[model samples]
Target: MIQKGSTLPEADFSQLKNGEMTNPKTNDLFGGKRVLLFAVPGAFTPTCSHAHLPGYVALADKIKAKGIDSIVCLAVNDAFVMDAWGKAHNADAIEMIGDGSAEFTKAIGLDMDTSVFGGIRSLRYAMIVNDCRVEMLNIEDPGRFEVSDAETMLKAL
Candidate 1:
């Protein structure tokens, strides 16, 4: 499992923007920034589609109020899928990423054997990564959603 104070996975994924792509590395992604990253099992699913994303949405201003530089929503999905979900949800304040291959998830040891639901899934978790090292983490129990909420991370921040 991923722990607090660990460097994020060094993986690169294609980010689509304006029909173009840029494959950015993990190091560059969190370089010198205070980032709030939360992961859900799937994009556009029940809990994530509703409560989880909304928590970030509702408190977008509040989260930023704490001096955080960015709030990101990641999933074990692809960049295209992630982008689509972002548009659908109107997550203008949250950065959405699709880790379709779970490269980042596995590198950080956050992968769960949830093939029972079809392939790997990310544990519901949130982390405050400062300039790449995790400062704090909140991991939720499987099939339960609580710890990773934006408010919890906000308090930790």
Candidate 2:
């Protein structure tokens, strides 16, 4: 598992931003910015759609006021699904990035095997990254959403 103080690994992510496809590398997103990044097992999953992403969307202004440069919602789904999910939630304040191949998830050691639910997915997690180095990491246990919600992260900030 990646620990606080570890720099994020290099990876490419696909995102549909402003109705255009964009490919951003790890450094492009985190190299010189304070980023609030949260990951879901899949895009549009029940809890994720109902709570996780919405929490961030609702609190995005406050979070950015706390010095966060960007609020990113990551998932192990394709860019198209992630974009649609973000649109559905009206998450204009959040950047929904897709890790379709789970490369970034596995690199952080947070990947899980979900069998029929999905071949591979990320465990629910939230982290504060500053200039590519992790400052805080909250990784949820299986089927749990305790530590990684936006309210908790806001309080932590």
Candidate 3:
């Protein structure tokens, strides 16, 4: 798990742009701004689709209002899956990001293999990072959920 007040690991990935995709790194995206980033195991899985992503989507506007420059949603899935999932969920408020290869998630020390999935993946987590530094982190407890929600993150901010 990532610790509070630590620097967030950098990630470079593509985002949907004009129906295509844009290549950008973590520094480029949140360079001098506040960022709220969340990660899920996959793009369209049950917990992610029904709960995690929606929570961030529903709070994107509010998160921005609280001075967040961008609300980024990341997954290990490819750009197509991430983009498609975002479109399907009406995730216009936040930026849909594709980690594709899980490089960023592992760098941040949030990688785990949920025995159920039988493969490496990013744990369900969320964090508020400023200038690439972590100001707050809300990593879920294994398979149990206690934090890592918009409401909790908003409160921290």
Candidate whose TM-score is highest: 2
TM-score of 2: 0.98
Model 2: lowest-lDDT 10 consecutive positions: 16-25
**Each prediction's whole-model lDDT (CA):** 0.83, 0.94, 0.83
- Assess candidate 1 and give its TM-score to the true structure: 0.93
Q: For candidate 1, what is the total of clashing residue pairs?
A: 1
Tens-digit lDDT track of model 3 for 17-85? 778778788788777888998888888888888888888888888888999999989888777888899
lDDT of 1 by residue, 1-157 (tens): 6688787868876566666666677766688998888899998889999889888988889998998898888888888888888888778888787777888888888888776775998888998889998988988888898789977877776
lDDT of 1 at 31: 87
Model 2 lDDT per residue over 38-126, tens place = 99999888999999999999999999999999999999898899999999999999989999999999999999999887889999999
Q: Which 10 consecutive positions of candidate 1 have the poorest summed lDDT?
A: 13-22
> Best lDDT goes to which candidate?
2
- Residue 12 CA error for candidate 1 (Å)? 1.2
When summed lDDT is taken over every stretch of 10 residues in candidate 3, the lowest stretch is: 112-121
Off by over 4 Å in 2: none
Estimate the overall C-alpha local distance difference test score of candidate 3: 0.83
Q: Candidate 3, 133: how far from true, in Å?
A: 0.6
